[model samples]
Target: MSLFLTLKVALRALIRNKVRSILTMLGIIIGIAAVIAVVAVGQGATVMIQEQISSMGDNILMIFPGSASSGGLHFGAGTRSTLTPQDAEAIMNECLYVKAVSPMVRAGGQVIYQDKNWSTSVNGVSPSYLEVRNWELKEGAFFTDSEVKAASKVCVIGATVAKELFDTESPVEKTIRIRNMPFKIIGVLVKKGSAAFGQDQDDTIIAPWSSVSRFLQRGSFNSVNQLLVSATSIKTIELAKTDITSILRQRHKLSEGTDDDFSIIDTAEITKAITATATTMTMLLAIIASISLLVGGIGIMNIMLVSVTERTREIGLRMAVGARSKDILLQFLVEAMVLAGIGGVFGIIIGGSTAEIVARYNDWPVLVSAQSTVIAFLFSAAVGIFFGFFPAWRASRLNPIEALRYE
Candidate 1:
């Protein structure tokens, strides 16, 4: 018989038992859909992370005063307050790869503007912060170096704070109270969404380090907390870190083996780590989903076996009329493939849309790539063949005489 005739027969058989056929495809549908949704969401999250890291400026290094600890154990990278504003300035002036540096002073207090009030983080930095972090001003401008030198009461507002206090009105030139100290609004930062660490990117205030130090008292911070530095290129991040370390050691007058007080966090290193983690998660999810697909394939094989038993007399009739074993196998295989193909089609649609809907409602980053859709569909088809072959082979190998004599 021709391929078309075999397919027509198989499809007719499926249509005869519509409910069973639909139920048999259920496992495949769920498996394929789950694969697509999980992969798409994972890819989206990875992209979001890269974007956030990039927005914070590439080739960037962060140096912190506290010791780096994970799971309550300190491993390394914790530096003492040996990094001063002078060290930051020396890096920019001395290191050939160093582009800009911003030594930070972190503080938290209630910000009061007229009748509205909100508590948020306050970062005391320099004019170079915008360059180091790749931050852009949506309105107004950053504080001038002279303003910082004089510890002027000028500040830059984050998107969230601006919205809360100004309500779409221009916040420029408006005075808001930070811990009762009046600060004139100089700039409003563009919204930067969120980071992989779940930190809000546009929720903190930026001010001159001098202003913060003078307002909060300079003696309170004997050592600088962190140094945000940007390098000329991604390749030069290591060079910049090495040069900065030497500069700090010489400036701080540290003896050998005392342990470096400051640890540098390279943006490229961070991005690589995040990508590795995301890839591992994706692989694990795909493996779990594949198990479900395997189970669904087994269900297909079981159903096909039952079908062959029920249709033994029909097979005997065909064989007695000179039909070959190959013909019998072809018919069964076609049926299995058709069932799987339909399930895969439905699964792709269901999974893609489900992922998109979830991402949209939850404000999650999600991208359903064509590769994932194609892979899921192909996996479903492969599952059908792997599971359906055994039953098809068994049915084809049956004795026509015995099948005919059976009641």
Candidate 2:
């Protein structure tokens, strides 16, 4: 028989048991939908993480004081105050690959404006802090180098702090008290939602490092908590790190054999680590979803076996009337393919809708690519062929007399 005739016969057979055919396709539908939805969600999370990291800065690097050992015990990084404003200045003046640098000193206190008081971290930094952090002013200008040198009580508030303290009002040119000392609010930073670690980025205050050291922290005037540095470009990040390390070691009078008193972190390293983790999670989810497809294929094989058994006498009658074995195989194979093909089409529709709904409900990003949809459909068709072959061959090989004699 021709391919078209075999397909017509298969369609009639499937239509005779419409309910059974629909039930057989259920597994394929669910499996494809789950795979597509999981992949969409995983890709969305990866993109979100990259965006958050990029908002931190452009080619940024952070320098923190190294750990100090006491009584044969070692303290963690940032436990020592070995980093100084002079070191940051030297890096800016000497490191060729460095673009900008800022010295930072941090303290925590209650900020009071009128009757409103909100406790937040106050970061004292040089004017270059904004440039190094890639932060922009929403209202007014940043503080100057002279202000930092004079330990002026000028500050910039983050979006969260501004909203909490002033509500709808712009915080520029206003005054707020921190640590019982009044500070003029010179600027408001543009909103940054959150950091990778889930800390609120726009929930603090910024001021001159000199002011924070003198008034809030009461620590050594020469010491800074950390240094924020920006490389000229991404390509120069490693070079900048090496140059800064060499410069700091020389400034700190570290010998060739001695350990350095500071640590430097590259933002690119953090990005790589986070991306790797996201990729692994996506692969795992995809693998788990694929197991359902395997199960669906098994269901198709089982259903086809029952179909061949029930149609044994019909098969014998067809063979006795001069039907070829290849024709019988083609008919059953086409039936299975039709079932899987229809299921795949519906699965794609359901999966795309599911992904969109999940993204909307969670306020997440999702991307549904055409490539994934096509691949899913093709895999379903392949599953049909692989699992339908054995039953179809068995039906085609049955002896006409024996099949006709069966109940």
The residue ranges of model 1 lying beyond 4 angstroms of the native Cα positions read 1-6, 49-55, 66-79, 114-116, 220-223, 232-243, 250-256, 267-288, 313-327, 400-407
The digit string of per-residue lDDT tens for model 1 on 146-180 reads 98778888899989888888888999999999998
| Cα TM-score of candidate 2 | 0.88
TM-score of each: 0.83, 0.88
RMSD of each: 4.0, 3.0
- What's the number of clashes in each of the models? 4, 0
Q: How far is candidate 1 from the true structure (C-alpha RMSD, Å)?
A: 4.0
- Model 1: lDDT equals 0.84
46-162, model 2: which lDDT tens digit per residue?
877887887888999999999989998999999889999999989999999998999989999999999999999999999998889899989898999999989999999999999
Which runs in model 2 stand beyond 4 Å of their true positions?
Answer: 1-13, 310-331, 395-407
Question: Which candidate wins on lDDT?
Answer: 2
Q: What's the TM for model 1?
A: 0.83
